[model samples]
Target chain A: MSELTVELAGVRFGYGAAPILDGVDLTLGAGEFSVLAGANGSGKSTLLKLLVGLLRPNAGTVRVLGGSPTDPDIRRHVGYAPQGLRMATSLPVSVTEVVAAGLAPSKGMLRRLDRKDWTRVTEAIEAVGLGDLSAECLFELSGGQQQRAILARALVGHPRLLLLDEPTTGIDQRLRPALVRELRHRADDGATVIAVSHDPDEFHEVCERILVLVDGRLQRITHEEFHHQFHEHGAPG
Target chain B: MSRLFIDFAIQAYLAGAAVGIAAPLIGCFLVQRRLSLIGDATGHLAFAGVAIGVAVGVAPIWGALLTALVGAVALEWLRAKGRLAGDVSLALIFYLGLALGLVVLSAHGGLTASSTGVLFGSIFTITWLDVWTIALLCALVVGAVALFYKELVAVALDEETARASGLPVDSLNVLLVVLTALLVAAGMRVVGLLLVAALLVIPVAAGARLAHSFRSAMLWAIAAGLTSTLAGLVVALLQGTIAPGGTIVLAAATVFAVAAVVGRRAARRHPRSSAA
Candidate 1:
């Protein structure tokens, strides 16, 4: 078997007494691209947050790259693109600046980004087809363009583990395939990729596995099984 | 205009210029973080500190600096502990500081000319020592911004992203507030405790509307700040009746108006290029 890049056992968590995720077990090996599906408030994003160490599980352990997700050393190899950008939209940060910031975590405090890091930033921008708008303020871009810029930020670091929440949000339909192709490329390059997406079928061909959150537990299903289940349920609302 | 170059006027100009340069430099982040009013809150707390300093016979600015620093830390602590929302914490500090300042000064023998000077700043009142102090603190603020520009911008842009990426989000937050406290205290002599936040926020607002990028926004903000301060001083000098703090804030507000108009026209001309 491929080396496990993520390991979670009997994880339980919630905002309050009522648990959102209970007795959840999941593990993903390197080079595996998995898509997580769930209804609204089914803890899909929360689970991704757990994997990124943004939230801690109330019970059980979450280990990524043989260490706790909260560990900075481990976090250095992780890239996360949340569903929606959580920044003040009014702030005049350019696409290039935002993508460059993706390198900030790995750079640590006080160390400046050298030329190599900037080259990586530029490459990521080019990869997302945003090279022309690199200097434009993020807020000035159309919704789809902004999403691509965020994707560029996530891709800039070239992390060994990439977690995305609704990564295709606001992306143009024509560009969706390319985005999925990029994810597959990252996974093929030995990165562990997990995406929490409402529409899992978009990733059907590239994803090796699909997991659905039902009543707070992960139900690992094959792509065909998910397709059948999805058809039967008329897809998650 | 000829009197503007005199030793006393030059000292005031230096002090005002320093505040101008430093306040907006730090204000760019604060504005981006939606903590623009933090300057006002800390300024009020610094006012209380100045009162305490006078009550105990210390230099008022030093007292303001110490109190503002402590207040800044306390505000962060309260927010982190989830005891109060950020705005509530700021409001609490704001009212408490002002009231405490009022009570302290009233009990200590009423509001004197010097204490009122702290309220409504006068450019001519600045000492060479005040100039040096403001310059030093301004220099420190500039150095900090220079050293941590990327980290600061990253944190301000998207705090969660910055944290998830491995930047020291919490420490950087503290540094921001600490630097804000320093700027508020340092600016009190030129713009006074009440109006210092104007220097901190208005210029950044104008700059953000006009500039296309964060770097450009910062540059524009500093330029606007300097313009407001220097112009306000000259106006106050010419008028001789108005306070420099009041004039400085008005000048900044004027700059904001022009930037808003220009930004609106530009956005109209290029709808796609305009910021949301």
Candidate 2:
């Protein structure tokens, strides 16, 4: 029973010949909440993906939940919400179905959702403020609303380890505090939450320390330092 | 309608009805995923497989299934590798499958009757066995679709998010392509290889236009597929010369055209929210 929820040492990764991440080392403990912020294409997304076991490092060890990331059990307990617009509006799925899919894999092959599953799905939808729109087609949603729906899907399973890349990109600033509180509650409920954001202030009260990426390297910085660099230096979007 | 009616017409009608429900049931997901061309690609490969099966004295449907599976895997692989876009893979597969089928057909002149059946299906030619084949396959296709319904929709919505959530994106994608292959191979007997994709796509597109939810979209698609088949079969029987394949595809297209108009009118009546 390792205390760390995520561990990566001497991690190296590249898409083709160009190195996207190299010589990186990181560790996160159980129930820890942390924020990773960096400029665009600064490997913030990559780190979140690694934690969720979505990508494998080329040259180093990546352990999630104290075991191989490729393990099915490890994958089942982890939830990930990727960055960017990941919806195909052409799909006819409703908000409920989209979030219900978070439970599909765990239900295993050839099984449909039961009463308990739907209950959880409803609760998750409500948490993201899309309870009224759960029956509406996802394509009918605004971008910010859609992003929150994705967040709800990620949190539906109450995963032991959760990773969100740029969770606030399309979200409204007014909704920021409630979203932070929601994530904080999940962390308080004994889950490790690692979020990637450009604005650390959104997560200042939730995270212990801010992790910054510079030239594919990881650096630990204080919240004050993060805000200063973020606002004054105008860290590239 | 009196003289055009044949003794074996019931089998053809039954087979068509089965495919009408099954093809569009799968097609709804395909159209949503924008992989509507997969049916055409698989149909072509199934043709090559059928030709080889005819030459070897085996069930042509089995041959078609094997070839379609291989082609589906190839399409999935090529699409995943980033070497080619999905439609590009579809085009490449259909061309190769047709080329392979032609070569095999040219080598066996005695197999003309069988090949003709696959290319331009005859409702009068359908036997009770053919109906059974269509029924069993249709049941399997529909069953698989229902069993993995959520997973399939999840992948179609967004592969990355689905994968991040621990759904087997690759496996589900493979299953979907193979199921598409199965539908096309089963449908080839009724709709013919050339028009199988049309049967898969048109009904689903029509359904998507009218539907407000996923379940409704699937139901509409199934209705469209069944209606097109029933209407097309009757028209073909009355016309006496036109194949059911052509008539069925045309009927589906007409349904789609009508749905397009209705959907547009409805959209105008209720404007979408200002967020695409």
Candidate 3:
């Protein structure tokens, strides 16, 4: 296994004239629980996209598992859950189908699924405590349940790195802790996890290190330092 | 009741109903995903194909099918590039196809009688061959959709999640675009290019107003499609001079209007109910 699961060496990205990430450097080693903290338009989401191979860096290099970010083989080792879940609300798909999509990168374009694929899918549903709801329509589930379903999808592929963009934003506050715990559990299992969030306090205990983005620039800090900064800034009473 | 008139009406109804049933089964997903314009665009592309086939002495159906497939690929490529929105791309492709079709018709020497037949579908002129073709195409479309239902649903709902889960989101999206093209080519003969989009969209829109679950929406859309096709055929036969395409679109629009009104009334009566 590579020492560094993901390495972004001085990456620069932008849309049109506005720069979203300006000469940002990042690295996630094997089995690290890293949190990306930033306000809106701070380029946190764009950085996640760079990690997952969805977007290429305008300058510098983005390497995932020692391969180009866009490589399907490299992507297979990365599990990504995007922010919004409203993209496919009208389709009548079950939870199982959604989770099973995680296996797609490994399955190739035209290959048929065998028994092993089914086992992975079943295990993924079970991991998220959604075994009972596997057959249920996704739209019928609560916001938290939907978030779990998305998590199951990211986990099913057993990727080396997990890239989640605001996985708990819409989830209830009660569920947020449990969700972070689940993510930490995955990291403990030797998977490099990088989660993007604005809620630094909620993730302080689980995230070993925090990377802050302010106006598209990057700053690395320890959890204690992040907490100290937050307290100094007057966190909510 | 005249026996000859009744027989003609029945045959026309069967032909129209076959395409109608297939269109909405495909349309429900398209409309839900905001890809409704793709259906309309492909239908017009098929029209241009038919015109080209007539001018070049090839089979019109085959020509229409090839052209629709090409248009589907073109649409997918444009979407992948992220240069334009799906609706904008669809509108551009559809108009380009129409312009090409007009050029082909003029090069072939103005408006011929065959051109008129293609524009305003001659339901009364439908042969047994046409019926068989529609049946086969419908069966194929239904079978393909059923076999890939799981993947299709996942892709249509949330493509990003689907891709993460390892579903071939791009391939599935391409398959859907190609399938829409195939359906349009098969249906162009029954409902002309100008009105083919109505067959695909109206029933789904109407059914969407009344359906609770995804399955129920598709079932209702299929039923609405069949009903409108049958009713339109009846009206077309009764009037004897009206185009079948116009009659069918009008009939579908009427069903959609009724469903919309009924849905709105039901929602007012029971605020918690899930209609529309």
Instruction: Please say which candidate is ahead in TM-score: 2 or 3.
Output: 2
For A52-121, candidate 3 gives per-residue lDDT tens digits of 7667788989997878866666777889888756565644456786787667666665455579999989
Candidate 2 residues lying further than 4 Å off, grouped into runs, are A16-18, A228-237, B1-6, B83-89, B111-114, B274-276
For B1-276, candidate 2 gives per-residue lDDT tens digits of 664455677777889999999999888778877777777888888889987987787788889888888888888777777765746656777788888888987787635665777876665687788888889988999999988888887787778777766777888889998888888878878988878888788898898888777888889889999999988999888887787889998999999999989998998998756342
Model 3 misplaced stretches (Cα beyond 4 Å): A1-4, A16-19, A86-159, A214-217, A233-237, B1-14, B83-96, B106-110, B161-170, B212-216, B234-242, B261-276
**Model 3, range B1-276, lDDT digits (tens) per residue?**
353366566667777877888899888778777788888888778778887887897777777888989987787777767864846666787788888887887787745776666665667777778777777877777877777765676566666655644566687788888888878876777787667778888998888777545667788899999998888877777777788788888999999999989978976785541111
CAPRI accuracy category, model 2: medium
Candidate 1 docking class: medium
- What are the clashing pairs of model 1? none
TM-score of chain A of 2: 0.93
Clashes of each: 0, 0, 7
Please give, for residues B1-276, the per-residue lDDT of candidate 1 as tens digits: 687777877888899899998999999998898888778888889989999998998898899999999988887777667775657767877899999999998889747888877876755877888889989988989999899988898888888877787777888889998999889778888888988888989999999889888999999999999999999888888787788889889999999999999999998897655322
lDDT ranking, best first: 1, 2, 3
The Cα error of candidate 3 at residue A152, in Å, is 4.7
User: Second chain only: TM-score per model?
Assistant: 0.95, 0.93, 0.92
lDDT of 3 at A206: 85
- On lDDT, the candidate that comes out on top is 1
Model 1 TM-score? 0.96
Q: Candidate 1 vs candidate 3: which has greater lDDT?
A: 1
Alpha-carbon shift of residue A84 in model 2 (angstroms): 3.2
